[model samples]
Target: MEVEKARVLIVGAGGVGIMAAYALEVGGKAAVTLVMRSNYRRAQDAGISIDSVDHGKGIREWRPTEIRNTIPDVSQEGIPPFDFILVTTKNIPDVPPTVADLVAPAVSPGHTAIVLSQNGLNIERPLLARFPQNPILSSVSMISTTETSPAVVVHDFADAQKIGPFVPQPAAEAAARRYVAVYNGSGRLADVVYDADVPRARWHKLVYNASFNPVAAALRMDTARMRMSRHVVDDLVRPIMLEVVAAARAAGHVLPPDLPDALIRVDPVEAAFRPSMCQDADKGNLMEIETIVGEPLREGEARGVPMPTLRTVYGILKGLQLQTKVAKGLWEPAFDDDNPYR
Candidate 1:
């Protein structure tokens, strides 16, 4: 009897990362290691859970290991390099910046394929120059999920799909074996397509993210409200979709001719879902504006396409950041002793 031959490293131990780990680990077919920030101690107590379409496909308990901490810099003491790497970090640019500095020293292009389970547009093109030889892939999800607590999550919605560049001619054999290796052994993933229209697949997700995220965060509203309101749909939502479509077109993305129709598809009354931007804002963390809305709008303007709606939303989000800052008081405190941000 032969065992599956692959070593795996997951860059995040957040909800998505741990879910994938459980999928891989229960199959008992792959070696899995998760790299997360030290703050994941919070996750340990939170009680996270995931349910798949198939029975016996849920992670009951997760005792995750921290890949590295105490030193923001990479250390050579432990952690063997792996054959496959899954980057499940936030879509913010800082994540990739940090990953490059931390993981690159231990990882090499040889036998390493990375799957970027991130959101936003144009994330792939930026990494090409440095990891030119490594097979880089992208994935998106329609399900609304959250890292409820380190230990548990209530998966409100569950739609997991992955699509990537057709594992180039050179690494086709290795990549496919590894792709099949995960789902075939684990039974946690499906609808994994490796072919053309991948960019379209990516942009399709961008449309969904942009439509719900900014509106929800800016209005401090939830998915259900935005989906239910005509004011949000006509005034705020549709315009943002237009800007997103413009940006996608400017970037040479292929989309249906009825781009607006494709971009703005929300349930008549939004599902019991919370947008990531809303979640991030509620947590008082840095939101993914720069990549999701800000960057695409800028890209469109740079390419002579107009994204007024996007620009407006970017401005509003920035103002909200300022309001948050003021409330938190990074400035000289009016009340020096107990400044909120302090």
Candidate 2:
């Protein structure tokens, strides 16, 4: 007869989260609710305005079924538990209230599948530890999008969104495939792919993110400028990318040998785009240094693979993060002989 609309709760109101919400609502496949801490009021007032080249000229505005400031707010309002909890926030483990903590309240075991649409490696560790019985899905987005204002977002380009089960359980895989169907049926904005090799897909994306994201933040330049400089590409970008491949191999995920070269040759049209890490740095927001760079470096070290380039870039980005905090008066520099980078 009729199909039931899947209920999805998006935990973050950033670019990715907003984009996912827009896609789901537009597709009519899910009843979406967004937990936007800062933009709840604005989103409720004006809805979300998406200026997307992928979606074309007119600004697409969508109001989810409800927008609440927090998970507790949803519970207080008597909203039902979400069928899926999609986390599109940055993977900052050191930050208080980890992803697991944020989605714990609304998670229904066996019913709710936690989808982590984030960058970096081993991101599902905490969630797996916290909710051992729940189905966890790892997702990687190739789309370029940015939230320009409280209620306005800009989508530059979208290549694909790959998803797979984090733990390889049948229930988890089924859940992941169902989520994929929703996106693929939704005008193919993401060009969703059911990646069987989750680790390889993660490492493949890491080859690009681990190399460019930190470098862009450290150098304070966009991708176009970074790619334009041969010295930067050869000396910095390519080196870091190779290190990622090495690290991935050491961690038992062997990526393509030519992946680094392919990543360095940025498409001229999307060249001007700044990665999320660089955008976060520009706004004095904390970058995902530990997750995006540090975790892989640690993995390599554990596997006896030396990632000198990744290590150096990780240190630089961490130092930049500390500087941003100090400038914001959130942290004070300690006058000690010990090197914080070390």
What are the RMSD figures for all models against the true structure?
Answer: 5.6, 2.8
TM values, all candidates? 0.79, 0.91
List lDDT for all candidates, in order. Answer: 0.63, 0.82
Q: What lDDT score is found at residue 187 in candidate 2? A: 67
Score candidate 1 by TM-score against the native.
0.79
In the range 119-164, model 2's lDDT, one tens digit per residue, is 8888899999988888899888888787778878888887378899
Query: How does candidate 2 score on lDDT?
Result: 0.82
Clash totals, every prediction: 9, 0
Residue-by-residue lDDT tens digits, candidate 1, 227-300: 56768878878777776776778788856767666445554443555678887788776677776877677777
Question: Candidate 2 regions off by >4 Å?
Answer: 53-56, 59-61, 72-78, 187-190, 269-271, 328-330, 334-342
Give me the candidate number with maximum TM-score: 2
Q: How close is candidate 2 to the true structure, as a TM-score?
A: 0.91
